[model samples]
Target: MSELCRLWHVTVTVAGEEVEPLIVRNALRRLSDQRPFLHSLKYAGGRAEIQYWEEAESLLDASSLALRVWNEHRESAGLPRWEVVGLEVLERTVFLSRGMEYHVIVDLHDVTPLPF
Candidate 1:
């Protein structure tokens, strides 16, 4: 089975009004439908503000999808300026947890044991 990881953060500002997180989330969800890799969204800082994004895959896919969605909506709606200011990768490591750090994102459907 193959595993995927995605994480990112973006900031969008309204020209003259406060933005809403729900709006951003909905927009992101719509983008996810088209991209299929975006997993979820998170909120921080304050209301009508986005602190970060937890994507299901990688920054490349997440950002690309988000940028496209934002641009499309921006051109049509003409409300807020959607901007992605930051993108980052979240890596895993074996540490004091004493367990495998990686996880399965999709079922492998394999029953054969690996030969060491």
Candidate 2:
């Protein structure tokens, strides 16, 4: 099968509980810096948005990379580990478009005591 290249809108959300917007913004910035693929990083409706190119050898690889980013960010950030309930990476591709779209959601719940 031929490899397909597409543009992706990667998103990570820390939802379920109220968090200071400033904190989220700072975390997003740091996350962006950790991931070189992200560009034009922004936030909307409590979600971190980034424009990236899914140029990995396979779609699975691309998705895996997104997951890794989420895990890494969560581990590094002073956030509850169990608070994260979901991590989603959706494809928002347009027909006949040169690249496919991607959206990732990292859901978080209320703060909890760190077990580690």
Candidate 3:
């Protein structure tokens, strides 16, 4: 039988040696270009948070991919060599149930790197 796929909302936080704010912003922009499916991107000199949705067969699969995102795109996006400091993965139903106050609706057309 084929495994069922589920939608997961993932938030990954990474941190590393400090760099200039502009550099971090530019790097995040590049990441957005490469990963347009990302819902939002926010960054500071030494840290960043990436939010997106992942379709996977299991939570573990989703978490594994989320953990690899930073390292996988580091060179292409010119991202800092950061380590994953936090990770949150919630099922779609659970995420939406958290209510509007906890959600940030992001329009791709209006997307710009946000500072955290």
* lDDT of candidates 1 onward, in order: 0.38, 0.46, 0.84
Instruction: Write the residue-wise lDDT of candidate 2 on 6-101 in tens digits.
Output: 444443433445456566556656656666566544443334434444555555766666655655777565432323334444444542253332
Off by over 4 Å in 3: 1-3, 100-102, 109-116
Please give the distance, in angstroms, between residue 37's alpha carbon in candidate 3 and its true position after superposition.
Answer: 0.7
Model 2 TM-score on a 0 to 1 scale: 0.51
Extract clashing residue pairs from model 3.
Answer: none
Can you give the lDDT of residue 79 in candidate 1? 28
Tens-place lDDT per residue, model 1, 5-114, is: 53444333222244565554455444444434332333322222222244546656655654454456554433246454444333223221434223222222211111
Candidate 3 per-residue lDDT, tens place, 1-116, comes to: 24699988998999999988789888888899999888778888888888888999899999999999999999999999999999999988888888732555565423355454
Q: Which stretches of candidate 1 lie over 4 Å from their true place?
A: 1-17, 44-80, 90-116
Best by lDDT: 3
Clashes of each: 1, 3, 0
In candidate 1, which residue pairs clash? 5-57
